[model samples]
Target: MSSLPITREQILRVAELSRIALTEEEIEQYARELTHFVDMLSVLDTIDKDGVPPTVTLTFDPIAQRDDKLEPSLPRDEALAMGPVTSDGGFAVPKILGGEG
Candidate 1:
C-alpha cells in the first residue's frame, strides 16, 4: 500500500473533535480504509483534463419555479374552520415529547 496521507493519531483527533466514540478496532479499521481510499483516488491525478470545461451539474435545475402571480384561493377563516383541530391561526397538534407524549 502507498504511504497513507492520514494517520491513526489524526483519525483519533477527528473523532474526539466530532464527539464520536470509536473503539480501538474501529479506529484501526478506519485508518486502513482511509489509507486505501486516498491511494485509490491518487489515480485521478493521471487523467489529462486540459481545456476540459468544468462540469456544473449532471442535470438542469430539477425544481422549476413559476412566476409569482395573484390567483384565486380559499379564504383563511374557511380553511381554518375545515380542520378538526385549529389553533390561533394554524392546526393544533398534540404535544410530542420523545416522539410521543
Candidate 2:
C-alpha cells in the first residue's frame, strides 16, 4: 500500500525465507518485479465497484470433493515389489542429503 514500493532489503528477506540465495542483480530484478506488481494492484483499486459482492471464486460452489472411501490396496509384498529398496514392511532409501546411508 505504501508508495515507497518494494526494497532490496525486502527482496533479500523474502529470499531468506524461501531458502534461496540471490545475487545483487537478482535482488534488483526481484525488487523491480515486486514494484510492478504493486503498481498493478494500485490500478485495480481505482476501478468502480457498486453492487459487486466479494467472492472467493467465480464458481457457484466449492469444487466437488471426492468421497473418502477406502478401497482394497496392494498387499505388502506387492507394494514393496515396486520400490527400489525395502526393509521390514517399509521403504529403504539411499542416503539422504547431509546424512549417512
How many clashing residue pairs appear in each of the predictions shown?
Answer: 0, 0
Q: Number of clashing pairs, model 1?
A: 0
What TM-score do all the candidates reach, one by one? 0.49, 0.53
CA RMSD, predictions in order: 9.0, 5.7
Which one wins on TM-score? Answer: 2
Q: Candidate 1 deviates by what RMSD?
A: 9.0
lDDT of 2 by residue, 1-101 (tens): 54566988899899999999998899999999989888778876778878888876687777998789998888889988988878989899889889988
Model 2 ranges with Cα > 4 A deviation:
49-51, 60-62, 72-101
